[model samples]
Target: MGISDTSTGILKGLVVIAAVFIVLAGLKTATNILVPFLLSVFIAVICNPLIAKASEYKIPKALSVTLVIVLFLAIALSIAGLVGNSLNELSQQLPQYRTQLNEEFAWVTNKLAEYNIAISSAVLIEYFDPAAAMGLAADMLSGLGGVMANLFLIIITVVFMLFEASSLPKKLHYALDDPEMRLSQIDRFLQSVNHYLAIKTVVSIGTGVAVSLMLWVIGLDFFLLWGVLAFLLNYIPNIGSIIAAVPAMSLAILQLGPAAAGGIGLGYMVINTVMGNMIEPRFMGRGLGLSTLVVFLSLIFWGWLFGTVGMLLSVPLTMIIKIGLESSEEGRWFAIMLSSDDDVEKYHTAK
Candidate 1:
């Protein structure tokens, strides 16, 4: 007798689940090698526009790639050196900072007691500890510093990728059957990714610069380090800005005072509000189209799988999977579940 349709569907579902489990296992085991390759791909995508611009000016492809790589390498090395030194100093000073934070907490508790507010210092601390924020900052930056260990490999990979990027469309054109349909899908996906990253990178740079200037003006230590941190974490969405702000605010509390810390916090709010809510929306239109829950869940999941690099590249990696799923009819429903309601509405509207 032929297999029942329900039985066949259940078997196919099990097969899909098994395949995902195997793929995730492989990715986790290969993270050390995969992380650098992924970072290279990200760098290559961001640098492609620079190469294209140079090519438009009649620059040779090899020379243009060389120039772009050299420029990026110089900048990357400078950031690594600066951030490394800053991290070492910060790590050494963390105990002192924590002590000072405790003193601040005690002082506040005493002041509150004088007013008969009756809040226990321990309870207050349990609910709010700025030092914890500093620890998070340290962890995030250290992860970035770790990536620099594989700098040579990543740069070389980026150089080759950038060189290949120009001719990739042509290569695919001849290689794929049904070039019209397949190429169109691939082209749309790449274009969407490129557009999103390019805009995000520009906004991140602006956020970093604005943050550095604000902290510098407020006389906070490690303004540049904090600025770079802001630039990197700004990619994470929702919580990224909050995470970036805390360490700077905590440092301000230690080095400057509560007033300066408050100023730094407010500055962060303003910068993120303008960049994320105003500027990005104007430039990006509807943003990445992924739901908020999806971004947050992916952040934790990818972070677990790939460590820091995974967290940093979570959105892009998820987008790649989502778009790939979207390209196949069988997976379109899953893609919709991953997307924002607005995107779902648009999908149905288009249908």
Candidate 2:
């Protein structure tokens, strides 16, 4: 290559690196601004059906919004209360758990030693480091003020969003001067988002309840906390079920002995297997056909971008992208690639 061409290439590389860092910095800054509003929008969508139903009875939209907000807040706080109680109980028994955990570690080391493999529980612990874990947790807790402040903002925004939802379309129409087109687009967008959220919520609730009941029957401590965890982590997809199962199994082992732990683990596996393999497929009936790699990468990317909230929002965000692509002819090919064969077959049959 000529010297000029080489210089141009180097310039391009620098530009690309600069662009990447700029984007990352922008995202980190924008996260605080966007997260709360996005959360509010999701909450508003969840309550949309109730708002519409109440409006059919000639209830003013404002009153409907107020009622929905009150009911939602009450339900949220009740669940939170249960979780808080469970956490307090767990804290009181931390010494027991700690003792059990050390014993378990010793047992594992001894078993490995039988094969002539030497392992130090202390060394293993230093490598796996609980102190670091505590430090990270302390940092998160220290940020509680900011987290709560943003959460309060989200709630206020959501309430107003619901209240103004009815008039939003009219305002958009006036601004755009293309009412029908804008309305059609908005309706489809909302429908797609709402449908996905509805399905996810039902699935999460079922998983949480099933897991909680199983733990309770097995005489595990903090059943409510595990249940709430199962419900929340169920939003993560693929890896979420496994993540939710681990702590419950640990608690079972620590409290009910090895046999109970094994049984609880087996039961959890069965529940997840049945639901993930059979029930979810029957209800969802083929996904929008996102590539498995794409789905996983998006999970990681979005999780990094927004933390736990991003992970919870991952699938919906991916679905939104899929819908947008499918809307245009050029992008239809991408949507097709994302679909499973069964979904394609079903869609064809329906057509």
Candidate 3:
């Protein structure tokens, strides 16, 4: 290419980068507004099936919506109560754990000293504060606190979204020129999202329950809190499972001996491996999957833009973008680039 052509292309790339930065900045700034709406959209998607099932029995739409909302509120309230009780107990018992934590720290320092690698207890304490692990868990809970604060707004938004969802296809038909094609694309996207959320919910619940049972059997403190963390973080790919395990494992080490802690860690690994690696893929299949790199990048990008809720919704949001891109004539190439090799090959083969 000519120098002038290369310069023009570079300028266009810079413009696109700047535009993306601006959009991200806006999203971060308006998080209070956007987070609720995004959450509502997801809630609406998840609850739509329940509403449909209720309606299939000739139930009125208002009654169906009310039934779904009531069920959702009951579940939310139960989780809130569990988490609140767990945190209250944890705060009261933290002083007891601190002594055990210090003992463990000393043991580690002594082990390192055996190799002629002397480390001071002060330095070790400074470097590894057990409270920090609790802080991490607290931060996750705090994020949930933010969501709970906005619960009413989110619920209202979901109710409206559900009502609009039924009429959306007709609205799109009149608004778009190629109504059939557009409706088909939208339907496919919704179906993909619904299926993914349903399967992921089941798998996450299984992981959480299994982990909680294992922790209980192993005599760990705050098993319910850890189980809830696992359920929530399981929404994020890769590092999420590790994040969920660290706090529980740290508590295990403090409460039990190293051997028991190791067993607890092993239990986490097996549960995550079985549920995330084995079971998820069978249900998710190739079509709904993103490239591994894309998954990581989406986690970082969305987390940066919208915080923890964004991280939780990252994969689904990226999937929606990919679906939208694939439906457009000019954007299909971008979608293909976001797909795994297997998916890319399938797309090409279909072409």
Candidate 4:
């Protein structure tokens, strides 16, 4: 290629990068509006299966949607009330939890000193703060709780989206110049996203329930809160379960001693293993198209940009983009870049 061609290419790349930055900046600025809408979309997508099943049974779309939404609201409200109460109780009891942490740290420091380790209890307490772990969980969930104040707006949005979903294909057919290919791609994207979110959310619920039950059986404080934390964080790939376990395990150490903490850790391991490694894939049928590295990076990037909700929606958001890219010949390379090796191999094989 000519030097002028190279120069033009460089200019185009620069322009594209600048455009991306501009869009990201706009999104970040609009986060307050964006997060609720995205949350509503998430809810709407998951509820689609119920709507479809209802339709299959010859149930009217309006009645089915109303029923599904009512069910959703009931569950959401119950979780919010319970978690809110748990957080309040936790805040009230934090002083005692902190005192227990100090005693636990002192005992550890004393034991270490017996072996000539000479670590200060203050140093130990500072680094291994159970309250910090709980605070992290609290901060993450509190972000969700804050969004719940706009629950009415979200419900309306979800209702509209659900109603529109049935007509979107027909709309696209009339709207697009070449509808067939576009419709096929849109259908693929919707089916993949819906199946993924549904299965993953169910697995997450299982993970949370299992964790809460184990914690309760072990007599850990704030078991319900930790369970909810597990459910929310499970949306994040790879490291989410670890993050969820930290606070609960820390509390277990402070309240129930190291043995109970060990048991709690073991329970988390088994629950995550069975759910993530075994059950999730069995239901999901294949890997998420994005690479493991991409998943982790998106979690950090989205979390940084949008906080906890961003982290929670990171994989879903990235998967949506990857699928969108794959819909066009020109964009498939970019999609492949976002994909796992297995996905890349399949893409090539299919091509």
Candidate 5:
């Protein structure tokens, strides 16, 4: 009987794994449709608080939503303009930078040759094309454009979502048998998400501003562009800061010098370390914790599934899933496993 039970459990686990993969495959296939809707949901969540604050001032719901949408559009357009101007300037300067970079590469090759190491200029240029860095910057900008391509759809969806937000409680009450319990669970989940987003948004903005100021002080071109990139990529965890630094640092090397570039890199390292390690945790508190391994894995999984936008939304999307799991008695164990060690210990003691 024990052996039979063990075999059945193993089979059930395998089936569950297969089902999860199937679902993920479908999600990836439908990313074009899903990405816009998911983005709308996220926007609605962020704007909900503003809407509530507006209500306290006796503002009508439709008018409040209109105000928030207008604010969002203005910010979006300003950022786009900054990025566009940066890209245009960078493209014009690329040829001059490319010449300088080739000279630097030749100098490095000669220095290595003095040390009895033969490095071909062709090989070096092929492997490390200075023009390729600009190309990468352009590609990154293009990826942002792709995300904005669905802007109209996302805005429309967000408007409808905001409209439905006030009616969600009534809908839940009508749909669920145990309305109070489900409502409490949902409230907890949204509160946690809102808290996380608020703190993260503030931190990301600080990071962007800090990075921009540092670059500007160092006399780097496109300071605002890099700052905006930092703001967007900071939404991604683990490697996001590193990715944001690369283009700026590369530019620093070409425009300034190795010594100045090193300083710029050090500044980024300090800023990310101080903010990500010290400041964010104090503000985040205990409830929304996720394991480090899970964060990195989710980044890769979502990036693969939904491309760049997926990578940006990975943490929030994963947190939503984790919170949903925790809201269910049967699934709480899985959620606990995904949480930090401290959270896992707390869960054990509570149980």
Candidate 6:
């Protein structure tokens, strides 16, 4: 390229990068307030299915909302209870685990002795130090505190959002003074969101159950944890399964020793490969279309902007953005670029 063109390209790239950073900083700031509300809205959408089913049984709308809310809260409390019990049990076993770890370290040192690695137990202990491990535990607890706080805020937001959900469209319509058109747009937006959620929920649950069963049969330390990871990560397209597998494999190695760990890791790899590469593609089809590049870039963008939770929500959030863009004439090209080529062709042919 010519110098002038190269210089222009460099300048444009810098400007774009600066703009992206500014937007990311704004998003990070907004997330403190927006995350809880967005989470609540998503929860309300999931519960809408149950609410509709209840309406089919001739239940009043208000009563159906109330019923779903109660059921949701009950499930939340039960999960909290289970997590609490698990935490307590883990705390009690901590010392025993530490001892086991020390023994394992010594065993490793002994085995290495045959290789002429004359490492003393004390030296090995120093190298394999538990102090850093303790520090990690502390950090984890601090993170857990933040997560729990976020969880409580999310629940509060969800309750209020659920209470006001049915009236929201009407309120917006009245305020806009174009009730029918506004309501129609709102309805379409909601339908798109609901469709995305339904597909995501089914896919995530299926992946989680499959992973959990595999882990359980293989005698992994925490099948449930891996299952939960699978479910949460399934929302992230392309790389989520890989990210989820790392912790599962690492923890397996720590708990089950290398041979068993290898087996567990292989199981995870196989399951994820089949689900992520093959089955998911077949099932997702073209309706909630997203491009491979869009999916990968969304992972990096959202993950950088909002941490682990953002990574988990990346694809859905991107899909939602794509849907919004698709709904507008001027932005249709952007939406098309975000979709699979196959889907774009289908859309064009249908048009």
* Candidate 6 per-residue lDDT over residues 1-351, each given as its tens digit: 699999999999999899988987898988766666666767877787677787789988878777787788796666455545545655565566567767887898889998998877777556544334334323333333455567767777766776677678768876976677657756766775677666777778888899889889878755775676677677777876776676556555556777886887787788777776776667565435777788799989876776655665677688778876866787888888888888789779969
The better candidate by lDDT, 1 or 3, is: 3
lDDT of 5 by residue, 294-315 (tens): 8899999988898888888888
Q: What is the C-alpha lDDT of each candidate?
A: 0.85, 0.72, 0.86, 0.87, 0.87, 0.70
- Score residue 195 of candidate 4 by CA lDDT: 76
Q: What's the TM-score of each model vs. the native?
A: 0.86, 0.79, 0.92, 0.91, 0.93, 0.78
Which tens-of-lDDT digit does each residue in 251-297 have in candidate 2?
66667777997998898788878777677767553333555566677
User: Which residue pairs in model 2 clash with each other?
Assistant: 289-338, 289-339, 290-338
Ranking by TM-score: 5, 3, 4, 1, 2, 6
Q: How far in Å is the alpha carbon of 80 misplaced in model 2?
A: 2.3
Compared with the true structure, the alpha-carbon lDDT of candidate 5 equals: 0.87
Q: Which runs in model 2 stand beyond 4 Å of their true positions?
A: 1-24, 101-149, 174-182, 286-291, 328-336, 339-351
Determine the C-alpha RMSD for candidate 5 after optimal superposition of all C-alphas: 2.1
* Residue 46, candidate 6: alpha-carbon lDDT: 77
What TM-score, to 2 decimals, does candidate 2 have?
0.79
Scanning candidate 3 in windows of ten residues, the lowest lDDT window is 281-290
Model 1 TM: 0.86
Candidate 6, after superposition: displacement of residue 200 in Å? 2.8
Give the per-residue lDDT of model 1 (tens digit) for 57-145: 99898998888888888988888788888878877887787677678788988998898888777786676565576778878877877
